[model samples]
Target chain A: MGNEAFLAIGIFVFTYGFIIAEKIHRTIVAMIGGALMILFGIVSQHTAIEHIDFNTLGLLIGMMIIVSITAETGLFNFIAILAAKIVKGRPLALLIVFSLITAIGSSFLDNVTTVLLMVPVTFSIARQLKVTPIPFLTSEILMSNIGGTATMIGDPPNIMIGSSVKSLSFMDFISNLAPIIMVIIVVTVLLLLFIYRRQLHTTAEARARITDLDPGSEIVNRRLLIKSLLVLFLTITGFFLHQTLGIETATVALFGAFLLLLLTGENYLERALSKVEWTTIFFFVGLFVLVSGLVETGVITRFAQSVIDLTGGQLLPASFLILWMSAFASAFIDNIPFVATMIPVIQDMGNMGVRNLEPLWWSLALGACLGGNGMLIGASANLIVAGLSGKEGYPITFMKYMKIGLPVMILSIAISSAYIYLRYLL
Target chain B: MEKLFYMVNNELITLTEHRNENDFEFLIHTKTNEAADRLRKLREFFDSDRVYTDILFYARKDHEYQVIVRRDVYVPFVVHLLQLQLLKSVEWRTV
Candidate 1:
């Protein structure tokens, strides 16, 4: 390795250390690291700009706008209340339904936002039933991660993967991963139900209170709800056909977002844009340039070669290794940065004679996304839910969560392993 | 504690006190969605959890709503009402 390679690796390691330590805000750390990369001539300013994936950033911003506006319509609350009433306010059923709703919502929206919308309603339902909200909260956290695994836009890892590899489209993600995700959701929910069954009972009168809730009244604005739903449906349709139409997913998402803004008038423009999570957007920007340092230095290429040598240049063993490693790593640390680094490594693997890179990509996606269920600190969604629950006087401690989270994560990964081998490898 | 009735902004606000063995509950009937939304937003600002707070909002028929305020949250709730300009003034008494 030359002097530039050494500097790049040093800077990369230093930046990653601070990110993992999390004492400083990650966005600031990443920005400074990315600046250092350019300052040291590890990567040129032009090259750094070239490395930032606008597709991922645009898709995130666009989806954030749409979800933020849709939330104002009170549609999520209405759906939660409607689901609770449908199941006759049974705590066990409420748990299952809420988990399903969260998983479904996360599949199409950001996981943290999905859990944020679900937590308050979950607490309200639990309070009415006079039961603990821990089971429901925990289940939603796990399901959000799992659901996010099933689509190109579902999880950040999948988004990065899709943008990096052009051949994997929205429909491709659904066809490839959605089946397994459905199975994982069913299995995980069943396990959760069995574990928390004893604590899910409530009084008959309490059940009646839920039934009395008028779901229709939860719709805060009928006109806005209709417009939001129409645009949302159209945007999802655009995603399904974007590949076939030879257009990028980001184009479709941004088009939908602005179209909704036009219809809703200019008043919503500032409010929707303000809610676009600029911190997360900047975090992605800094990470892209930081990783570009390693990519340009050829460090990632050499690491790829070593990984192939370790696995004897075989696809099956390599795929399994990525699957398991990603699961455990994602469970403990931020999966976004991990996935960012791994994308190029996997691409380098493709160049180094890994004939079928399909399995590797799928393994990475499944592991990085589902692995979030391993611990409370595993994903942003988990921590958000924990924070909200703690503020409500029902803290989901690390150990308390892991007692259930670890086993479920292992079981889901096991199922994913079997599915990958039987369907793709074998 | 007693049942207190007042008029603010041409709207009737009734506060009914229900005494438990150890704690007291104040049911503040706002009787309109506009006031209910304001109170709910205030409660949300104070307590993000929305349910476990000393204040809870219940929706009644004809767009009417009632806010259940516990003793601990009474002062802040009253202060919010004053700030929102829904309450004119709070008279102090030596109960």
Candidate 2:
């Protein structure tokens, strides 16, 4: 009704339109919306930048550097090789091992890291086995989201969700959802085996083609490797000790990375810096400004209140409500920005006496994250993996990813929803 | 040791500062003495034949590198050396 509300609608409209047309990059679209919000005086410039969530950025950057070092060490490669060796050329066994390892990494770190660190290595093994790597990658990506479901720091959405709700913790992930996470992992592997069985290499020639086949490797620098591993170990220790030591995750990670740079002794410091995707970071800054405008315009708060009333202050029904909407929204909207805006909506739901709606937070996080894999433009990790795959000569068209990704979305959401309902509600 | 030839743009590939673990001799198409010398040395290291007791170059075509692996064990060891070489070379070309 007010000028601010009008402006907010305009920003949202522009964001959606810009994204849909593909005329502007998402960072630019988000930046434009955020800039417009500030220009219209919907939110002050300070809040616009301030709301961008540097915690997420810091965690991501810190982890990327650490993961890069680990990747360079060929630890990930060695792990995949171990899986391949342990599977001993069994397609289904390799699928399970690969998926489980990827899920574990994704849960602790994030999907993009897990994927980046795992995919190429997976590709190498798949090449050796003379089989298609798609099923393994698909399962990995899906399991990544599902695996991220089990841990607070596993996914950005989970981190955001956890930070917004205090009843949850790093430990809570292991205690509350570990069983369900395991269930999803088992189901995911089984589903992948079934879905891709026909594609499995059974021909005698193809079978022979895989035995002791070639995938690339790197020259091992034991000094560099040991040094990098030390830094990584320290980083993990710092991360776990934070609650008692009263340290921040970002500070620990940043400091650890700095130490690694000092000790790595190679030119990888600069190379590593180049590896950080500032594009995604800027996108975050831009999206925050855009979402802040929506908040400033009072539209978001109003929307939140109405939704709260509609749910009759019941968290159980609200959990379902948020689940479906978040899933769909995630399919279309950028999950980071979506998660950013929903922080307030979640608070609004809380204010309406949705007691222990904390589990609802998990649903929102898992739903959006898993649902993000639904479409081409869902998650940052999706775009990254797609681009990486393409760079490696395996171009992943939107249609192709969606073919597998869509079914993955449906199954993951159903499983997650059932888990949340059973865990939280009657 | 064995030499496997992988000719990339007419210049033989070499991993300058890394240890060799494969027997590969190859010609790659490229212009640079460093590239040629590196390739030749790699071939010598990997070459089991020991054909060249003297220094000479073939008159035509491109540069070739000789790469040799120190031992024989499989599971993509040679592939690793090739990837590292390719990855470094590719990174160099791009930068």
Candidate 3:
């Protein structure tokens, strides 16, 4: 390896090590690592800037703004309250219903944002029913990750993957991953129901309490709610026509966010902008430069060669290896950076005369996304949910989360394995 | 030790807490609104990682309602809630 490669690897290792240590904020770590790369001449400032995926960052920020505004209208709370009433406070039914809502919510909105909105409502219901919120919260986290896998806009990793590969469309993600995601979600819900069956019962009094709740009352601002819903509808429609409109997903989402802000009036502008997760945005900025260094140093090309060698140049073995590797690695590391680094490597593999790269992309997406459910620290969404629950004095311990999360993650990956085999391997 | 009270909606709302930063637990007495709804909505946001609420109990004593609620909120949010006085009480006690 060249001196530049050595320096790149050193910075990458140091940065991710700090991230995994959970001592320093990841954004700061990434930014420091990125700065080191530039200082060490691994990548120039211009090259590093070019490596940053504005599409991914823009899409994330835009959607975050929209979700921030929508959340203020109490739409998520209303949904939770309504779902509670619909299920009559039955714990098992609540789990199933909320999981369905989470999964679907994640399919379109970002999974982290969906979980953020849903966790409070879950806590409220659990408290009302006098039951532990762990089962419901865990199930929602798992379901949201699964649902986020179904659409290109669902997860940050998916957005990175989608934006990296121009030929891959939003519809392509939906068609390829949605069917298998449905199966995984259903199976996950059943597993949760089985695991929590004993604790999934509530008394008549609790059910009565939920029945008394008028979900309509939860909508604090009906005017803003209407406006938010309209813009959300248009944004989703724009996502569907992403290719037809010849516009990026980020542009569409930004348009929707701004339009909603405009119609809702300029009052929300400051709060909405402040609500954007800048740490997450900056983290992406640093990660892009770090990964770009790896690419520039030919590190990704060499890694792809090693993988090809390990698989003996066979497609099925290569596909399974990528899937499993992505799952395992993403279980511990942030899948966004992992996928960002891997995309270029995978493309390098394709450049090395690997035919049929589509399955590999699907495998990466499925493994990275579903793998997030393997542990509390696996995905950003899981961490957010865990943090929220922890603050509510219901901390989901690592062992507790892994006990359920690991098994479900393995099951989902197993199902995805079958789907990949049937859809592409055969 | 001190107790401060304010009357809103014809119900008394009281705040009693230790005068220590470490002590976030506060006692609230009110009858007009549900504690769960109040605390939950105050801490509500789309993607905050530093918000939590605990509404312990509600007991009615001859048309009076008293509930103990705890909140571990983001620093900024403390100000937001204090501004809105979601409880309709600018009066609080540092006991």
Candidate 4:
């Protein structure tokens, strides 16, 4: 390693420390680090530009727009209300049903937004049923993360992974990860039910009240809901055709966003566009460049070699190592940047003659997604749910969340381990 | 009518501005007053219990200014006040 490599490593460490400490805004820290990489000539301006995965950014922004517009239609709330009505205020049944709803919703929509939409309604139902909302809220958070593993568009990390590999399509994700996620979700739901079985009882009056809930009133605008759903359906169809149509996922997503904007009117365009998480998009940009600097300096290659040595050149052990490492690291740090950095290292392993890189990718996806439920601060959806619950006076403390989240996370990863071994190895 | 007040450190510190909802854009000088006086007057304002208020601290200027909202109307109120509202860095604590 040369002085340039040292400089890049120093800057990368500083940026990551600030992000982990959360003293300074992550975007600002990342932007500063990215700029320093350019100033030091570690990565040229043109090289930095090339390093950014615009497909990931475009897909994120486009989906954000679609979700924002769809949010206004009150479709998510309507779905929540419908779930509550189905269970008729049975606390255990309500928990399972709502978790299923959240899982299914998150499999298509972003997990954070799905949880955000579902939480308030969960709280309301809990209030009416006179039960603590912790179990239901916790279940939803875990299920969202679990469900988010099922597709490329389901989670940001999956999107990044999908975009990084040409062979991995949206359909491939659904076909492979979806089945595993379904089994894991069932196991998780069952575990949570066993843990919270005592708290599942509710009053008869509350049950009657839930049955009385009119889900129709939750829809703020019928026409907008119909249109949004139609466009969303079309966008998803486009995703399934990701390879067949020879169109990038980003292009398909952007097309869907534009089509939605046209149908929804340009007047509302500004509002819809404003709702996109620009900070997150920019965070990706900075992270990509920073990781590119490491890759350019051969640091990632060295790390990959060390990992391969640690695994003794065996594919199964390497997959397990990647899976567990991703899970535990992602439990504390933001998995977006963590996964961003890991993708290159994994690819380096592939370049080093590791056959069937697909298993490694699945492990990374499963670990990053499932491990997010290990702590309240692990994922955006967890934090959003915690914040809402806290505001309502049922604060989900870090320790409190981990008490349930950590073990469940461990169990889910264990299930993934077996699944990976059975499906890919042996 | 719009009720105007300034707060710091989780305490309603002063009443430097008062205006109707239409006059919300009119800035008032609350910086010149002593912190204690501001706190005292703010206490007096809330003493009457005229309406429900939710204290919302600006995320950036953490100690600078807090907008008091009646009931849970802070979001829409802030949105309307800012016109082009961006929830970029705002960490809303509904206390």
Candidate 5:
């Protein structure tokens, strides 16, 4: 490696280290690293800009807007209450229902947003039932990560993957990954149910109180809810047909977001825009440029070649390696940056004679997304739920979460390994 | 303890205090969303993780808001009510 390559490596390592250490805010660390790369002439300003994926950023902003406004309608709370009532407030049944709701919600919405909406309600329900909310909260965290693996727009990693690889469309993600996701969700929930079955017991009177709750009353604004639902449904439908229509997923998402804004009038414009996670968007900006330095310095290609040599240039071993590695790495570190860096590495693998790169991409997605279930700090959603729960006086300690999360993560990845080998390799 | 009435944001807010063995429950009845919004702001303040106040907010029908404030949180909750201009003055306690 030359001077530029060395510098790029140094900057990349520095950025990754700080991001993991997390003493400094990650966005600031990534932004500074990207700046250093440009300052050192590792990548030109134009080249750095070119590397930033607007599609991923746009899709994130669009979805954030939609979810932010939809949340104001109290729809999530209504759904949670409705689900609890449907199960007649049985704690075991409610646990399963809440997990399913969280998974399905994470499939369409982002995991943090899904949990943000669900945690308060989960606490309220648990309080009413006189049971601890740990099981419900942990199940939601795990299922959110798992369910997000099933859809292109579900998780940040998947969004990055879908945008980078044009061949993998919204429908493609659903068809390819949703099957395994369904199985994982069922198995994980069953395991969680068995573990928490004893604590789920409640008085008959408590059950009656839940049944008496009017779910409809949770809907704060009827008009806003109708408009939001309509737009959401149409947006999801647009995602399904975007590939067929020859449009980008970002375009579809942005269109849906603006349509909701227009329908709701300019009153919501400021509020919705304010709610967009600008910090996360900018973090993506910095990461793309930071990774671009490696891409420009030929580091990614070298890494890809090393992987090929290690795996004997075989697709099966390479795919399994990516899957398992991604799962464990994502469990401990931020998966978004991991996925961002891996996207180009996988692309380089494609160039280096990995005939079928499809399995590798799927493996990376499965590993990075599912790996988040391995520990409390594995995913953003986990931390958010934990923080919220801790504030509410029920703390989810790292070891406590890992006891359940680590095993579930390993089991899910094992299932994924089997699925990949049987479906594609065999 | 005592039932009190105050005018907040030009709307009447009726506060009825129910003393429990461990905490106090204050039933806040209002006729408009503005009062509820203000009360929500108070709830939000106490709900923050940084604050060590133990409070629970229950949104009931007919514009009724119930707040269960623990003994430890009562002082802070009352201070917030005064700060939000919902309590008029701290003298309401003595009254």
Candidate 6:
């Protein structure tokens, strides 16, 4: 009815259309939309700038820099070669280890980056093993997403939610959710087994083939390895040390990145940063303004509150909606921006006295991260893997991915939902 | 003018078209002949919406080739199939 309301709605429609069409880069669309929202008075420039959480941006940039430089040290290649070699190119064995590494890595670092670093080496390993990397890669991404869900600094969505909720602290998240995540991981592995049962057995003399492929002899950089390991350890420790030492997560991450830069310097670091996907970062900044407009106009609060009243505080419908719908929605749209937008909606639901909304947050995290396996564009990891691997002649098609990923995602998310319902809400 | 079909003994899945900036690595998990056949078909026509079309073939390469492989193993293969040529472009699958 009101002009501001109409403007907000218009912004939403435009953004949705641009995202779906995808002819335009998502970050560009978001940036333009954000700028226009301010120009149209949907949000004041000051308020829009205020809504931009530089802490999240700084963390994303800082870690990206560190990851970019560290990955160049051949550490990622080293790990991938080891994972593949340990399995001796066995698909089942490879799946378990790759997923474990991805999940564990994502829990500390950004999930997409974790996925990105692993993609190239994983490809090399699969080539060596003479089996499809699809299953192994899928498990890694799924695990990364689920594992990333446990930590506050793991993904952009978690970072946004963590910063928004005053009562929610890093310790609270790890303590409350980590136990449940363990159950989630087991269920995830079982789902992988169930989903890719046939692929597991396809391991024919791929062992010799793996040795033949060589991946340039899996060069071991012990000194670079030691340095990368040190920075990563300090960064992970900084997550827990934040409250007491008063060191910001961004500071630690950037510090690690700086250490990498100092060691690797610009020549090597540029190559790594090229892989960082600043477009996604801009996508974040843009969505912040677009979503902030609704918050500015009091629309997000109103919508979230109204939904809470309709649910009568029942956890079932809200939970179902959060888990299933979020997963399905993420299939079409990029999950990072989508999840970033939902942080406020979930937080508002909490404000409306929805008890146990933490499970709801977990649900969103599960759907957004795992559903990425369902389609190509669902997650940055999928895209990065595509970009890096595509150069080598293996092209992952949209339909082909869905054939494997759809069944896997459906079962995995369902298993996760059941796990959450039984462990927390039930 | 120039097109070729090479069997990959490697696990990497690739899709390329004759024209178009859209390119990608596809994930293929064909457990049976039929499954492999279908994946070959899909990768062949993946870029129908894009510029040019090509034929494809699916065969297990007996060994690493004189050729080069450039895709990521762990990435979901579909994300980059936008540029894969169809199997029709290839005359046949060799050993």
The numbered model that scores best in TM-score is 1
Across residues A12-128, which tens digit of lDDT does each residue of candidate 6 receive?
Answer: 779868977889888889999899899998888899988887777777887777676566455665566566666676677778888888877887777767876676557556654
- Give TM-scores of the second chain, every candidate: 0.60, 0.32, 0.37, 0.24, 0.77, 0.26
Classified by CAPRI criteria, candidate 1 counts as: acceptable
DockQ values per model: 0.33, 0.04, 0.15, 0.02, 0.19, 0.03
lDDT, candidate 6, residue B91?
A: 29
Q: How large is the C-alpha RMSD of every model relative to the true structure?
A: 2.7, 9.7, 5.5, 11.9, 3.4, 11.0
Find the 10 residues in a row with the least total lDDT in model 6 chain A. Answer: A211-220
The per-residue C-alpha lDDT of model 5 at residue A322 equals: 97
Comparing 1 with 2 on lDDT, the higher-scoring candidate is 1
Docking class of 5: incorrect
Q: Candidates sorted by lDDT, descending order?
A: 5, 1, 3, 4, 2, 6
Candidate 1 C-alpha lDDT tens digits along A1-426 = 688988999999999999889899999999999999999999999999999999999999999999999998889989998999999999999999999999999999999999989987787788768799999999999999999998998999999999889999999899999999999999999999999999999999989978877677667778999999999999999999988999989998999999999889999999999999999999999999999999999999989999999999888899999999999999988899899999999999999888899999999999999999999989999998998889868999999999999999999999999999999989
Query: Count of backbone clashes for each model?
Result: 0, 27, 0, 3, 0, 44
Go through the candidates in order and give each one's C-alpha lDDT.
0.88, 0.67, 0.82, 0.80, 0.89, 0.66
For B1-95, candidate 5 gives per-residue lDDT tens digits of 55334433335487888887777888788766666667867866665453332676656557776677777777777778878766776634334
Per-residue accuracy of model 5 over A38-92 as CA lDDT, tens digit each: 9999999999999999999999999999999999887998899889989999999
Taking the tens digit of each residue's C-alpha lDDT, what string does model 1 give over B39-64?
A: 65665565554445466554544544
Q: Candidate 4 falls in which docking quality class?
A: incorrect
Residues A1-426 of candidate 2: C-alpha lDDT, one tens digit per residue: 598788788878878678666677878887877888888788998887776666667766887777777666656766676566555667777788888898888877768778877776666556545577777767776777778777767777777766556455556656776677788678767777888888876444534433333222231346777887898789877766666676556777788878898887668888888777777778777876787777767777787788778988777778888887788788776777778778777776676666676777777877777777687677766776677666645677889888877777777778878878888886
lDDT of 2 at A144: 75
lDDT (tens digit, per residue) of candidate 4 on A1-426: 888888889989999999998898889889888888999899999999999999999999999899999987768767877777776778888888998998998888789878877776676667657699889999989989998999998898999999999899999999889998989888888888999999878879868867766566556568888889899999999999989999999998999999989998998799998988888888899999998899899889999999999998698999999899999998998999899899999999999988789899999999998899888889989988887778767888999899999998999899999989999987
> What is the lDDT, from 0 to 100, of the residue A23 in candidate 4?
90
Pairwise DockQ winner, candidates 1 and 2: 1
